[model samples]
Target: MPDSTPRAPVLQMPQVVVDMKLPQIRELATQLRFAPEEGRIWMDERRMVLVHSDTFADLREELLASLGYEMTRGLLTRIYFAAGQRDAASVLKRLGPGASLKEVLNTGGRMHALQGYLLPEHVGRGLAAGDLRSDDYYGEALWKDSLEDEAHVARHGVGQHAVCWNAVGYCSGYLSYCAQRTIVVREVECRASGGNHCKIVAQPAAQWDNVEEDLRFLLPQPVGRRARIVAPVADGGPTTALAQSAVTDSRDDDRAAPRSLAETAFVGASTAFSVLRHKIDRVAPTQATVLLLGESGVGKSLIARQVHRRSQRAQAQLIEVNCAAIPEALVESELFGVERGAFSGASQARAGRFEAAHGGTLFLDEVATLSPTTQGKLLRVLQSGALERLGSNQTRVTDVRVIAATNEDLKQAVRQGRFREDLYFRLNVFPVVVPPLRERRDDIPLLVQALLQRFAPLHGRGHVGITSRALQALIHHDWPGNIRELENVIERAVIMLHEGEMLDLQHLSYADDTLSTPSYFGLDDTGQLMINTDYDFGASQSPASTSAASPAALDMNRLADDLLRQGPGQLAAMERALVRSAVRQAGGNITRAAALLGLSRAQTEYRYRKQQSAPG
Candidate 1:
């Protein structure tokens, strides 16, 4: 069932005069530089006047002319009985006869009372009476953080720096009056919840500002003890009923969040997986260049395929080009194609990656390694959608989508002049960063099962599954080479597995020696000394030693042997200990620990969190 809810209203203040008898109050407001046109005063339920307050000085003269009042500056407290609303007498009377003038000036409590008057029953009846327009009831809630600072000055006099809260309150109140509805103004601190710095919320004033000037023209001239009803006025205004119905229909169309491609296509429910899939969907349909960034062996090519599969041009072929694998001199011809007899190597006409991918996509792997000349040609294709074949003057126009991948930082390459800025911007229109296997560690078991199923059938061997302990080890290991490394390890393990056996840690190919060593302490996997700690020379050690073994030597040989036989759980524990020690020494500085261990900050942090969350 579709939901139905009334939206809030937008409000606008009108320019009008404020009747003031006291010259001193007017003088004070003028000295404060408040403009009169921005605020109005109500006198004895019969007269309405405008006053100039310095805060809105731009509208001061206009406000005076509108009210047919002389533009003069003076104190106004004694002269102005009430500001805003032709029905002020009844509003003030409801506040009680003995209410102090100060109580009336206290806007917060009065504002709350006004909200109470907007009860659903009252609003419904008002709508029925044609006195209240439904269009005046709905508007988007806008919050400005700076309102509190402004309010503080309005409530309390601005000392050195003049703050205008009166102007704010007057403007907000007049807007509500024009809308014939209550408006709530909330002054909220910007940084209170570690969100925005400040926010001022104005609510339920619906389109008030949009039609306020028209409302002012339609307002009846003041008469003694009663608000004179003027003739119905229309500034060629559209019917409010239509607006109300549209708002109602729009509410039905609202959704909490958008559905992802994985959710809609494969019925996948994992949020992380769905987010990645959604990113692919958004980037697929457009010709905008996409940069796919992920660690090595993280199925970047698989993601590229998914993008191509979901794209409109999926009927066309998707060509893959590994930039790093191609010779620097031949990279341009490979991408842009070459004419027959263009060069010594070009014996026949050959369509390049771009031509082959016409009406489809060209996937460039390791794009950061492209030669500067290749980068320039790629930029031209992206900019002009036209390419020149090698040794040919004719330009071929190709409608091809581009998807580039790199594990390295292209931005850094651009800064170093290794990558062209124009090409980088063109190709980096949308960037999809594929998370490493370690990030989506929960998927490790699924991947392992799939790999085992595939490899077992290929080898003509019985199907095998990983034991819980072995799986734990696989999840904990820092997959430097990512999925490719995992696949190799699983394949090797499957090859070595015996019949009727669930694979255990011993069956796995990874051992203590295979793991990277800790360079900071000069420690290997088995606590063997790879560096001499006896060197007292205080100098920055080589980056290579950051992952080496500690200099201390003990039962190092036995420890290494034990680690080799033990499962990944044991190795993970040792790694955690090393990380914790480094973090403690660095005073919880993860970056320093990462530098000490020759690991990236993200890698160090991930490992730390994994250890922290592991079951005791």
Candidate 2:
């Protein structure tokens, strides 16, 4: 159930203090490009160019004039949300993984100050009632030369409501990036509104009062001006902008827009994906046994790695074992290790997966494949954190977190007596269902861009991209193979693609889905027949068209000549197509199709299923 009670703010009306330790601020250089992580300010030869505050102020005025208030606010909010996320990430990146949360927050605040958005005077720390990490952060800023505020004041002279739309977005984006949750910031008082300074309150999604209003600012919207795709730099570094991908639907709600938190792996924006990621992060820190359930290409292994990366045992190695790949007889020895001189060919004692994964994670892919004896042993290990070597009687203690994955239904297996009911209950303590690629279609654009970036260089193809139409086709197609299938398609295209060519429809090849609907093939009296290539393949003719031209009257020599000209592969393809056409015309009745094809019923059914079973 969702938490119903309102979560109190981490710090409300925090007291300003002196001697608050701040990170070493980097000196301003010629080029002030935002880092890819968005957490730090760095300088690169081919880096981000710094702009004067006046430039931002001018842009704000122009946007307001052309796009109106809400639209302008939405645009600027998205822009700064990205900037803030980068800035927060930059802070964390520079500080390293060991840096304290306070350091990260403070450094992020200081970076915004240096960027001339506002001077952060004070910040609030500590956790709220349900705060998972030290994520709920609050701070106050003195609006000194604030671009949005200054722009608003110049145009409408101190209005009733606050005018720091950009700043609010920046704060929300930065904090949200830091917390990995939706954090909205609102300006209760502002300098442009005749207030002394800007006072803002920040909290989680359910904690804030005007959350709907603030959250609206962080939503995504299309730009009125023509957009361009920013190619990677000469060094092959990718752009960090959220809106840089292909054209998006105007109806895309901000609440449902891409999060742009895609790390080295795993990317998506749909609600199904968002929930899956949240569940992973929530369970990663603990030593809970996780059972990942999904279809074969749903990226369960990747999720397991994510869990291990975030777990307390991250410093240790993550040992993986494919239960189905191992021979049934060797499953126990592989998992429990073997002792020297204990069995035939047991020359030396060796540690098994559980021992190797001590103090870390053990990923058992396709756990349902374990035999009854192996399953009993696994249960014994789970019940007691001890295991005996295959050839030895000594029981050694092992500390390991088990994360099991499978494409099959374990509950059904248990009911059928194939799997242990106790093991299912134990592993199902944290059940996560990884959504297939088809379910998260909104993520295709980003996935395509990411796949190209990662694969192009490896195949010697320079930075590449996809056309809009090709991307739309990819989004509409139901990916039965999921991410793995998409990656395979992209990689194959990359191999054949030219140095700088973009991947369009011509490069993408899908299995044949077109099924011919016809009973038989025949010729007309005039040796010409009608069939629409668009609607009809002329795949096969009907009895009405064939009755006049009997088989005895046809030219056998010409038929043999045609078959000889086409190779075996082509002949096979033609035969399969004809078989499919017959089956379809017969309404999928095997005996009827066999009669039409002059073949046995078993032969007809086998061929039809085989042709239909091929990937499409």
Candidate 3:
């Protein structure tokens, strides 16, 4: 059985005696570049010097030279050294009878000057390896050896021991030592491996700033600090003429504010909106192409307009193009003007969007939808700042600011080969991402009020106020369609409401009903589709029974097998069936159809479009 008893604590020793070995002492003397005759060793309670008689004067001179002071009477002392296994017993044997051991030990072990030595090759190798394990091991060994010496001193009740080193330690030991409360000695580094030579660093126990200043003085001067200043100002107040000139300069700056893009831009108080505003203001004046990114209905076009309005070419026309709305066949001709005889429909010459907006700004909305050929032309225009009209050899030089906006992730599109990488980067010089309305819901009330005022007159209704309950509901509803959806809702409510009427729950439409229920639609345990009919679809069949037959009941594992058995139109028929069932169960209400399918109105509409686009 192993012993479970705790080990006894060992006494810690000072490092002075451990560091006084012949080899280490000699190394220190060599580092200091001192002659052998100039130094002496003492061992009798550290009071008696072991020096040759001829070198006594040399020893005294060396001591004075190293310490920057002369050694006088009482400076040297005798110390006791033990002769046996135990340090206490050895000290008693070394000190002769009638000699006061305590007095000798108390006055021994004092040196005016101290130095540390290290090899550069070892340090460099350790650093190059990226790990300082070897260096740390060396430092720990030195510290442990010194500690043993300290223990020996305590056992004998002799003089105290001190350990010192140069800035170069086994690794970071020097820095660790400096972090401690007590500093034992001065550290120095010998940069002999390189052009740097041995240098002394005297680190005192206190006043670290002075040590830093000393290091600064030793290092070579930096170029920046060494550079001379050509201009100097006298300490005096500016003359009256100079003050008047400064006032005139201030007026001129004010007059020049209108010419700057940033000066005319709007500032928002909200952090996200303010950052967007600042980014727009900063990038507006530059000719660099700008990309505006955001979700649908986030006012990306408004930001693009701001970019064009504040730009240097604001005086020229601002041409707008919607890539998603334009037919793929006409996109190329629409971008680069078509010649009269270029195609059957071209009876007259017409300038393209880019040509019309030359020397101004060209705003491309839904830019991700641009065809590959048009994208190539756009890339050329960005790279060369020149474009050739269709069926024309003449290349027209354009000074147009290109600001493109997209609801889709263009980088992802680029990776998918749906967009050109070179064109994406060219137009992405400055990207301004507009925050979704849901993210900045605090602006919802302000936006609603503004829209209410704008649309009330058109709807032939006086100002309609929203009830507190209605406003709270609006805030809670996740406006997936964003501000555009909010505008449409307010407009519909205003048309239905009488003048001075407050909008209530009847006027509001909430989108969170389907999102709030987890069982409505999600994957089940077997990776099969699951649906809950408890949601208000007004279905004739009970929710529990209907849910069992819904898509959620279909096994996805068998989907491939099922697809092989069915025709190509089977998937389309399934989707149509689902939509028809949802709409019928909701009594043909599209809003309830959206809720039954757990989709937003816009998403439902998009799905409808996809169904129409599907092949028969």
Candidate 4:
């Protein structure tokens, strides 16, 4: 009687990349940029506008009243489904090249968090590294703080059905785009239906028992409410996998779209970049000698490339020479062609950079470092496109457009007699001053994204996100070494990160002076000078707190003393008592009590309920 029956074995979930590391929450916030002066808010390249939650609730209530529940659900689901598809495309484009399939899939959750939809936690495993296109693929996730559920519950009270219709549609569309197959993500449990939190399960459409029921909402019109089936029926025809293969085979002539040069090479959307671009365009078509002035590592070379690309001679070769890198004795031969036996070690005749760049462009970087003798030769080439080969006075006629760049002041060099004034005038026909990285702080996020895409694959880190603190640090730092220094820091940080880890502040290596923490001096209530280290100031003060002493400030030292006096094992009891007192002070209003306790309403309610149930 005790033991003849066999027990069913517990089902095990399939393993996937559950430990997907995300960018720090703070870092995600930095992606949203406010430009009140320009009357715009931007999240990456996309424009965004903030809308009140109550406004959304109003819309939802109106829709429910007008269209009825089923129609409203279908309408909202299809709308959000389309939005999710766009989000998928934008996110994939933003992550850029070298991003792994896992990163692309994992970032979908981050995208939800970024848009204030919900926070997704994988229940057992994530589908980040799994085969998303598989017919039997299944993914389970728990959603906390779902905005749609909260809105629905607030407007309509507790619903009889799971009410996260938007989330379901969004996840379905997003996953479908990423997997290139119809993925039906159903909200199995929702707070509006009296569940603790929203829980969702996703599977390829064909694998779901009620796939038609789930996808019917995605169809248009009144038919969506009455339709029993949708396209790609669960039981008939070829599977999504076979269909995808057929499509792929038929699209052999289709190619990936070309990326913009500005997005890939000269990534920036700042006003400063726009102005620079305008200047480059103005002079790029002309034969005027261009001078690029900027600090070292400020991407003068990239500016030069942009100019060359936009020029009439773009079809020909572009020869670049770093004048400072060559020896002073070899500068003349490097600029002007050299014949055999021109120098003691000269063996064979070779064309100089100018001859090599015939009917093309010759970019001279750090041109200020060229010797006076070499400057004369450069002036001759710029004046008449004529140059003499060293040790052979045969003047070589060549047609070339010169684009010179330098970190040093060429005018000052001319004044100092290190460079010829005539040559300086010739090179200064159209001077383009590239702004430093610090001057255009708004462009930092774009640059960081580009750098991450470039360096992550080189170090085999796949796609690494940066912590919020790290991004804040990058934004605040005055990049004295300019873009080049930023490149080194990003590449080094990528190298330091292990697989499945985000780049953090600790991984960054900056100049000692740049990394130094400065002390702050402020006047306290009595106008007496008060000094605080940044650490103390930031740790002690909240963003809402003013310079004056705040009554709500926590006396950490006193609290610790009291805690020590109470000894161990009393922390939980004290917390319960504190929560209970806060509830009483707020007259049992959980929302007000949560504010008093500096906790969320849900948290305060949970604790108060727990305390009331505990035995005394």
C-alpha TM-scores of all predictions: 0.41, 0.46, 0.41, 0.51
Q: What residue pairs clash in candidate 4, if any at all?
A: 27-468
Preferred candidate (TM-score higher): 1 or 2: 2
> Over all chains combined, what TM-score does candidate 1 have?
0.41
Q: In candidate 1, residue 214 scores what lDDT?
A: 24
The Cα local distance difference test for each model comes to 0.50, 0.64, 0.48, 0.68
lDDT of 4 by residue, 528-561 (tens): 2233211122234332222232212323433443
Error of 4 at 64 (Å): 27
Question: Over 4 Å off in model 3, which ranges?
Answer: 1-269, 510-616
Candidate with more favorable, higher lDDT: 3 or 4: 4
How well is each residue in 144-226 modelled by candidate 1, as lDDT tens digits? 22232333344433333212232234323433434445443332322223323232333443434443322222222223111
Which candidate leads the pack in TM-score?
A: 4
Model 2: weakest 10-residue lDDT segment is: 228-237
- Candidate 2: list runs displaced more than 4 Å: 1-264, 511-616
- Give the CA lDDT, 0 to 100, for residue 3 in model 1: 12
Give the per-residue lDDT digits (tens) of candidate 3, residues 92-120. Answer: 22232343532222111111112112212
lDDT measured at residue 523 in model 1 versus the true structure, 0 to 100: 20
The best candidate by lDDT is 4
User: Could you tell me which 10 consecutive residues in candidate 3 have the lowest summed lDDT?
Assistant: 77-86
